[model samples]
Target: MSELSVTTRSGPNGPVVEVAGELDHDTASEVRALLSGLELRPGTQLVVDLTALTFCDSSGITVLLAARNHVLAAQAGMALSGVPDRVQRVFRILGLDQVFVTYPTVEDAVAAWPQQTE
Candidate 1:
């Protein structure tokens, strides 16, 4: 299995975690564990920058949902940024694209994030 990696970058709003490599059952657990410690305050946007994600399975999708729930519970916004077409197809098929705010890029998401707060 290819190793999964995560990198984080922060802005005035909040942290955007960049996920790379294969995200399957085994590696998904690491993501979940990391997300468990996230502090998504009210109005902060937690953007999952999925630009480099090579692969993602059902377990990965579940972790994404969990992340969404965590941010929503804290009244913060959650967004998927730079999602590959493959992943977008999955979200579209599942009708999750309608529920989750998706952007072409992190900048686009961040630009819209402040609007959601207001």
Candidate 2:
């Protein structure tokens, strides 16, 4: 299993979390903790960039849902991008596709976020 790593950067809309490696039972909690520490503002869009994500299991899926719930509770938006075909398939089979907004790339996801007016 690949070692899980998460990198973050600021985007125009909000923070972009770049997740790489396997997000399994062991690493799901780490991801959850990282997400929990974020300071999300209302209307901001939190983009999870999965371009380098190697694998994800049920535990990872649960963490993803929890992240979504967190963002929603803060009145923010959330999106996932660069999902691997295998991971995307799992989401489709579980009908989570309907729950999460997905994009082809992080750029596309970030671009789609609602622009904030000063």
Candidate 3:
């Protein structure tokens, strides 16, 4: 079993959460709790960095979806960065690739955020 770790940081777009772990059923609730505890201001663009994630199970996928819903409920934006190729393949296989917006890096995700309207 791989250990789970999540680090949160403030960024120009919003709060960026860097996740490193094997996200399986055993660890998904912890991740979900971390996400649930966040208070995103309106329009904040949340980015989840998954570059160090080694594995993700269905429960992990559910947690990710929950994160997305949380952002939406707060009227904020959310995206995933640094998704591993295997994870991407799994998402595609599950037809979840279309449900998520992912980028190659944090910078890319930040750059793609919708500019604040004047």
Candidate 4:
């Protein structure tokens, strides 16, 4: 299995977390911790870019849900971008596709992020 890596970058609306490689039970905690530590503002959006994700398991999905919950608890929005087709299918089967907003690319998600009202 490929080693999982989670990296964060500043986004137009907030922070972007890019996850690469295999996301399974072994590495889910790493991602969960990082997400839990983010400082988000009410109008900001947390973008999780999974473009380079090679694989994901149930634990990975749980971490994703946790990320969503973290953002919501902070009064921020969350989106998933560049989700692999395999994972997309699983999301659909689990009805998570309805729970999470998704974009075909990171750029698209950023463009669609709602602007903060002054």
Candidate 5:
């Protein structure tokens, strides 16, 4: 099985979590834990970068949904960036394409974030 790596960095809008390698049952918890621990605030946006993700199973999908819920509960927005075509197909098939807001690049995701009003 391919190893997974999940890293986070501060972005202009909020936090950007970059996930690389396989995201299957074995590694889904790692991603979930990190997401659960994120300090998202209202009006902020969270972007999950899946550009380097090579594989994902049902467990991975569940974790992504959990992340979404976590962000929403914090009153923050969320988006997925650099989704692989294969995964997109799966999302489409499951009707999850409608559930997630996706972008071709991380920059696009950040740019799409709602501007905060002073």
Candidate 6:
């Protein structure tokens, strides 16, 4: 199994989380914890880049939901980019496609984010 790794970077839209490796039961908690720690400001857009993700399971999906909840609680928006076909199919099958905004690339998501007016 590929080990999960997460990296973060700040963008004009908000925080960009780059996830690599397998996102399964064993590593879901780590993802949750990392997301929970983010200081999401109201209207901030959180983009999760999954371009490097190799695998995902139910637990991983749960963690993604948790991240969305976190963003919602902060009055922020969340989007997923670079989702693999395997994972995207699961989201479609579970009807989660309507729950999160998806983009073909992280740049697309960021560009689509509502700008925070000064």
Tens-place lDDT per residue, model 5, 2-34, is: 599999999998999999999999998989999
Per-model root-mean-square deviation over C-alphas: 1.5, 2.9, 2.5, 2.5, 2.6, 2.7
* Candidate 4 C-alpha error for residue 93, in Å: 0.4
Identify the runs in model 3 with alpha carbons over 4 angstroms from their true place.
Answer: 115-118
Which digits, one per residue and each the tens of the lDDT, describe model 6 over residues 40-78? 999899999999999999999999999998999999999
Q: Please, what are the lDDT tens digits per residue for candidate 1 over residues 24-77?
A: 897998998787679878989898889899999999999999988888899888
Off by over 4 Å in 1: none
Candidate 3, residues 20-117, lDDT tens digits: the string is 98999989989999998899988789899999998998899999999988988899988899999999999899887888889999999899887521
TM-score of each: 0.93, 0.93, 0.93, 0.94, 0.95, 0.94
Q: 5 or 6, which is superior by TM-score?
A: 5
Stretches of candidate 4 off by over 4 Å are 115-118
Q: Model 4 over residues 1-30: C-alpha lDDT tens digits? A: 449988899999999999999999889989
Candidate topping lDDT: 5
lDDT of 2 by residue, 1-118 (tens): 4499899999988999999999999899999999988999998999999999998998899999999989988899999999999999998899998888999998898887775221
Error (Å) of candidate 2 at residue 70 is 0.3
Note the Cα lDDT for every prediction shown. 0.86, 0.89, 0.89, 0.91, 0.92, 0.90
Error of 1 at 15 (Å): 0.9
**lDDT head-to-head 1 vs 6, winner:** 6
Give every collision pair in model 6: none
Please report how far candidate 5 places residue 114 from its true position, in Å: 0.8
Residue 34 Cα positional deviation in candidate 4, in Å, after optimal superposition: 0.2
Can you tell me which runs of candidate 6 are displaced by over 4 Å? 115-118
lDDT of predicted model 6: 0.90
Sort order, lDDT high to low: 5, 4, 6, 2, 3, 1
